[model samples]
Target: MPATATRADRSPRAAEPSPRGGRMGALWRVLEGPRALDVAALLIGVCTAVLTVLGLVMVLSSSSVEAIGSTDGSYGLFRRQAMWAVGGLAALLVLRRLPLRVLKGLAWPAFGLAFLLLSLVAFTSLGHSVGGNTNWLRIGGFTMQPSEAAKLAMALWAAAVLERKGRLIRHVHHALVPVLPFGLVLVVLVLLGRDLGTAIILTGILATILFIAGTNRKVFIAFAALAATVATAMVLLAKNRLVRVQAWLFGCEGLETSGDPCFQPDHGIYALASGGWWGVGLGQSRQKWSYIPEAENDFIFTILGEELGLVGSLAVLAAFLGLAVGMYALAARTTSPFIRLTTWGIMAWLVGQAFVNIAMVTGLLPVIGVPLPFISYGGSALTLALAGVGVVLAFARHEREALRREGAPDAPTPDPSVRPQETR
Candidate 1:
């Protein structure tokens, strides 16, 4: 109420939301206010929900024959997958409201717990080998891959560390020193689990985070090349990995005459090849009838292609690309180095995971049991991914508020008075 202030002198309450805001402005206020991040979440959410439903249908198609013999009902695996989908969505909704700071506080503990689980699985005698990887722990009727949690924990921890020691991030000693122990820990845990795929994904996330934190580019590149070398070596040493790699690179050169260790990839390639342009039909995928292995998990995209065609598969890929683009865009929009780094890291993680999964299915890369996010048929992976999405959404919402508060000029509203000039 300054005396000199008149109605015209006052800033317009511009019908549009405010745009000028900083980090503190993204915090959730005590009073209810407009949510600015809903749009991003909605975009991601709609895609996930669609994929979830699609997953259930495909799981039913892919799992029924095996389930009929393994369980009393034909829908056993599909039923369980559906339940997990429902539960995962609920968990994501709950997480969407929490502020990023709150989650950051829990990051260290989460990382510790994830590491503990990885160790426990090795000793407990409960860890079962699936497709030659001893990474799954079964408790009662429930089973989960601890590595999924490990991935999220690692990302959060990286973000926290980089945020706290940002200035030293440019120095080799301080920057790489901090990440060295963590990298070692992750590598050892994953090596013990024999889950090289998960380890590779973690490496990608770590590298992205480091680069964003201003680590020396040459150092980052050296670390990356080293990781690639180790991964290739591990694959070459293991029969399972070798088979997949051979299948991917050579495409069944003299292998199919005997035992066919790379049979799954061959089948996967067949499935993709069968689907020319459109697809066979919805729920009518011939390859899912016990042809391709892990039809619902590692090779779900192939099934999507087989049933829905190249168009469907490409659509899914395009959506993933769009999501990554949007996430990175959001990160860049914010000035906070932490948000920027974390956002880019997460986006890289998604891209790396997606490419690896799809590549494994299409026989372009060696098979490692990574699932397509949101679309694959696994509860633990899906749930952990949803949580990550929640983090991004909260940041996005805060970002929108920040944009509004910063007094960013609103996009021009439609001119009701002016109709567009139509072509004569």
Candidate 2:
């Protein structure tokens, strides 16, 4: 007591601990534990598993009638889908284990291979046409859609290039040069094969990557407008597409029921309407009995809705929403521009395609021939989609390691401007 203490000095030397601070400390401690997993990574993995399993079930149910009619028996299509599922899961496991550097190294090669495959589809005898879109390649007894592989390849290539550009991406010329030209060529290739749906999805992937890389605002808007114009022109130029658009704009009324322009849309609506709030029950969809074409492919959602009702439909949407949240969270947490852009690009591919498929089935949009990501019956689509997820999972694994090394707090903030210290 060198001097008389004031009233403030006489008060307690330590202030009471804040409840919020205590909770935050507890959370950090939990996250810092040795066995801790990244919440985002877990969420994504779980959702993917759920959707894929559900897809297999729905494929079996929806394809039974078609499979029995077209193939050896009811299980033929389901068996093929199951085999592809096995291959896809294997890919997911292998990809999730690879280092991010290895993925970056593979990007260019993937792009080149995709380009070659697409070229074969567009100009060679190997090209196989289905539903008027010659986007598939046939060899011996096997067939695959090159455009599906291109979707993943383009996303990877764009992310790798744009991330390397760094702050230079702010310049329009630097941002658009090779990326824009290469992307356009890929889209043109797909279009040459008459796959407008795949072209649209590919264009979306490019735009998403560019936006994530922080391209100039004016340039981005201009690019978007140009893309819209091209898409509209392409639609108007195709008689089939134009007819579908007309059906979407004007009701299917006054058209002959036998060869109706809105036959698919009308049947899709009927399937959904037949199922009340609870659905008709699994394996009981009358739509799959040939009322809706492509019951196991493009219009699987309608069959799902018909059998499982609105509840099942909502469940599928929730799974996709979960995927979206998880991917967004991973993208936000990573400091690597490649990881951020790739995550966003894949997100656009899967989630965007899912919504487009659902919209088409619901008649909110014209029939685009896009498959629902995990639930569709195409081997190429399922395999590539899983591979894309695998790449993102690899990024997520890297993020989890980074968090562990840094001993992340309750809310770890990453600076996007700073280059990540650990490239591997």
Candidate 3:
């Protein structure tokens, strides 16, 4: 017929592989799209959904005992957790629809609000102390952790500030002036609560944003050293925290003794070890029966290991890893510098905090009382973390649309038999 039809004249779809090799291959074709942004957004959605479901199941299982003893029944805690999950999901949906211009416009007020709330927690009668950290504020019958909100606010604020500073970022003073003042202020307030874990996470976010903004190596180093010195000084000034550091270093040997400060770590290890490879079976963890402290909060990893074994533990790790990879890919592919900087800052914050939580649980690092992100049971932390994930998703969507406008390859097309409109 067209006996000499050239390759260039052939339809581009003719030579493409069919999505029929295997289940995994099909999934691969779908996820490995023409543009990385679409794939990343897809991955973030899938991971967030799976993690949220897993978190709810685990929270119900782990909190049943405490809920029954203190409240109406086992479902008491589960109900509250479910409500928080619903609220968080709603927040995510709403955040996804907001335009980037609106987000940028709100950055300053968000930062100021974050600061005011943090100040109230740190310095006013509104502060509520729990488990040795005065980081919560009780306002008008509602209890909220201001630091969690501050983390998201600061990320937005820093991106806007640094993106505007653009070329001026090469100068040390311009790089440090506004961000350092505002960032260090929020961090200092976090430290005022003696919540060192949250403080470290906030500082990590700040450092990551600075690095992404292209601050000079020498200036960054000096800033890092100053931060480290301040952190060390704060730790040394607090007796309980120094004791925790000491226990982390040399107290494992005395774990079997009653009243030892290492009891928590020792129990955490036992819980993990008890699960072997297949786990003790979901909801059957012995450690949840008053063995591991805060089993539904900071130390939830221990219960996760005990109930779901190494496989479940690794699944959580993998989900976080997927999120990190997806966010980083978006950061690299986006044309907008603010999007790039903000995505990287968020990727660092969530992924770094996740590993920090895991490390503390596995005894690879000192216990820092940091939650395991999407898998933890706390209300404020879960809600804010979900909101951050939503922001990243929004950015990914923007990039995908922008790429399409530039005539970049579209996402995978569907079969006309199944989705006729997608055939074009």
Q: Which candidate is the best by lDDT?
A: 2
- Candidate 3 lDDT over 1-424, as tens digits, reads 1233332223232234456678757654554446456778978888888888898899888888766667468877678878888989999998887788887887899899999999999889999999989999998889989899988988899999999999899898998889888799999999999999998999889889989888978878888898889878977998777777888888756444335668788899999999888899998999888778768887888898998999998899889888887787677656677887878877777889999999998999888789888788878888988898888888877766665554435645435455334664
Worst 10 residues of 3 by lDDT: 5-14
Q: Between the candidate structures 1 and 3, which one is better when assessed by TM-score?
A: 3
TM-score of each candidate structure, all chains considered together: 0.83, 0.87, 0.87
Where's the lowest-lDDT run of ten residues in candidate 2?
Answer: 6-15
Q: After superposition, how far is residue 7 of candidate 2 from its true place, in Å?
A: 44
1-424 per-residue lDDT for model 2 (tens digits) = 1443332233231123224447656543433333323766777898999889899999999988877756469988888899999999999999999999999998899899999999999999999999888998999999999899999999999999998899999998998888989888899999998888999999999999998899999878888898889889988898778777877898667643445778778999999999888999999999888888869899999999999999999999999998987787667656688998999999999999999999999988899899999998989899998999999999988866765555546645666566667876
The RMSD of every model to the true structure, in order and in angstroms, is 10.7, 8.8, 8.1
Model 2 regions lying over 4 Å from their true place: 1-37, 253-258, 408-424
* Candidate 3: segments with Cα more than 4 A from true spot: 1-33, 252-259, 408-424
* Residues 10-65, model 1: lDDT tens digits: 32321243454664344222011333244445556666666667777877877776
In order, candidate lDDTs are: 0.73, 0.85, 0.82
Residue pairs clashing in model 2 are none
Candidate 1 local distance difference test against the native: 0.73
Clashing pairs for model 3 are none
